[model samples]
Target: MFIGRQHELIALQRMYDSKRFEMMVIYGRRRVGKTALIDHFLDGKTALYFTARQQNSRLILQSFAMAIAAYFNQPEVDFRSWDNAIDYLVSQARRHAGDKLVIVLDEFPYAAEAEPSLPSILQIAIDHGLKDTNTMLILSGSNQGFMESKVLGVHSPLYGRRTGQIKLQPFDCFDAARFVEHCTAEDAVRYYATFGGTPYYLAQLDPQLSYEQNVAMLCFDQAGLLYEEPMMMLREELKSPAIYDSILQAVSNGCNTPKIIADHIGLEPTSVSFYLKTLEELRLIERSIPFGEKPTSRKSRIHIKDPFFAYWYRFVAPNVTLIETGSGVEIARKTAESAVFATYVGQQFETMCMQWIFRAFRSGKLPLMPVLTGKWWGNNPLKREETDIDVVAAEPDEKKILLGECKWRNTVNETEMIASLRDRIGLIRGYRETTLAFFTKNPVHETTLAKYRNDPDMIFVCADDMFRER
Candidate 1:
């Protein structure tokens, strides 16, 4: 069943309502629901959809001709060339001058790769006829690099042609919860942490099963759909899956810097940087600098951006041999009960808290709306050690700041947690007002809640609060 993407639907509807020629570019990683969103939006509309495949140009053209013929309710039609096919499409759009006809070229890169001149042909068609017709032309692809460089880049033939673009992203924690509505809030969080927000991955989860059961089946079982999903994706997107796997494994094991990752993988730092850039382009990993630092800060760190990939590399990749030997169930059980897994969940929980803070700020639920929000890590001079804040936000003038600590444990020492957070307030200088937020997996102690009940600067957020729909 379809889930979120309400904003995307609204945007597409707005474009459709315009009743004018529109060129929309939709692109994202595979399984991120770009196709699902497009299908949903075109549910009752008169549209021609053709998904290109990796094949010869002649076969792709034949398939495109078939789709067009079907759209036009013809017995059969053959287009001799890309120019003829595009010209025919424009002619159909011109026939329906006042009606919006959506022509979607899904997996456009596949077709473009098969026929290198397809983009220039479409560019000429758009310039000569399609742009003035009543066609809402949409080009969608899963190859972000191809879509960006070949279709959306400044030097591309189709440059300055698209009226709108949507770089579809994965669902956030809340939208992801919809797939496992029967699961408890905590269990839902765990499921999200494990499977991540990819709709395809989440749909593979059966809500009837517990989080551990789901993980065991989906991740541990050799026959499961996601058992080798990370490897498959890497092989699909990269030239050297083995090298990428090592880099991902290193980053997942806490080797965050280029030099450290290179050392762990036994590669030169310069060589690793090229592979990292490719992964970044594919949206598998990200490079991040601590909040309040410049973009070029040396403190920058690399992280696996997808939770499922991170979880796989950390928990499954290391135990692949055991899993293949039919000992996966035991390992899954131990993983669920291990402190290491809890630590991993806690790290994901911090990210959820950051998402919650951003949503709250946008919805005007925050005490002070800050201009910037992110994780902060640096040296704590007073303590003569390094420290990190789970979440940090600052106002435009840097006079107001919000500091947060996320605790995924069942029980927290409220007094100590508060004191630790309070002590770190000095890390950010020149803050006139400081708001402290404590995010926990479970509710805090009764007395702790009562003590901070009336404290304006103290904000307490639990898992339920984070899951609650605002």
Candidate 2:
């Protein structure tokens, strides 16, 4: 069942290929496949795998002793301290026939939190016990904050000790498509919008279920896995989960600007800024500006980085009480009737188009192009309003710009769509070398597609083309 972790497996092989003492730190949000990657890498190797618990130091030490004993087929080796247990492990690793042993400490942050001195202890073992032995030490954790502050931070005793670090991210749209075989391009895009590419969420989806049915089971079922998973996740990560939830809810509900979010949540802008920065650092939320500006000189807005959390805060959290007091099916029916999923999917579709546009530029699709990019508008002169362009390619020095539109509708009228693209090009200010791209739910018009079939300037990229290797 392992899919789409080619890079991580290759990295593990490289570490062993060195044949030196290796210390690796791997961390990411829960359900992002860190454990799965480690398990996949250690499939046939002589490895010791142990998960740390949130408990007292003595209890954790006992559990580690038991894990070590189990790893070596010794069921009853009693060790008083981690020092002794790791000493025995190093000895066992050296005695084994393999050139190197992989030792994985999954959720190492929890263990370090339970025993504040565990990292120093591991450092002791690494320096004195395992440096000469053929062993690779892998430490993994879910708490980005704790991992950074306690183990990886400069102030930590074991700082400057790790040889490598890996942050496991969700798979992109293509890898996710493998989970549901029969979905169309549009269906796959919608599924990614709702569930994201998190492996855990994709695994929960039933291939036989329709999109709406899967959403009902995921967010509205009484005993579903994801019904209250967000609450549990924040409770474990934050000191005050309620405040964190409030901040996320405000951002997810279209309160993006710092001042706007502060006003909506009734918190001072300064305090909200700190929380937003922490959330951004944790990769739970993001701060973005208009696409083409310098990182420092644009209006910043907050967004929930994880799609599942965004969906939960937008729909499920707002209606949790009704879902609890009334029937789950009734609430889900009302939620689906609101067309929220459609809007979310539309945004994801736009994102996919933009990614492909940038990719095409990188591959020399556009001749002498400075960048393939996007622009957001606080005020539009033609519409006399504000909006964002989904994709924008501009050569600022040449005063040239290209505008594009993305449509996730069931069907698109190609003649009308091309006319609209023509109109959009006319609205640009510093305009030159105008071009258009259309990302459609279905294919483009026959004559229109044939017209641009050989043109390099005007392009139509399908969703599958977005992730293709070429």
| lDDT by residue for model 2 (341-435), tens | 67777777775676566656777875547454665545556767665666777787887676777887767778877775665654556666777
* lDDT values for all models: 0.90, 0.77
lDDT by residue (106-131, candidate 1, tens digit) is 99999999999999999999998888
Clashes of each: 0, 0
Error of 2 at 453 (Å): 1.8
Structural similarity to truth (TM-score) of each candidate? 0.97, 0.87
Candidate 2 backbone collisions, by pair:
none
Candidate 2 TM-score versus the reference: 0.87
Model 1 pairs whose backbones collide:
none
* Residue-level lDDT for 214 in candidate 2: 85
Q: Which predicted model would earn the best TM-score?
A: 1
Q: How far in Å is the alpha carbon of 88 misplaced in model 2?
A: 3.4
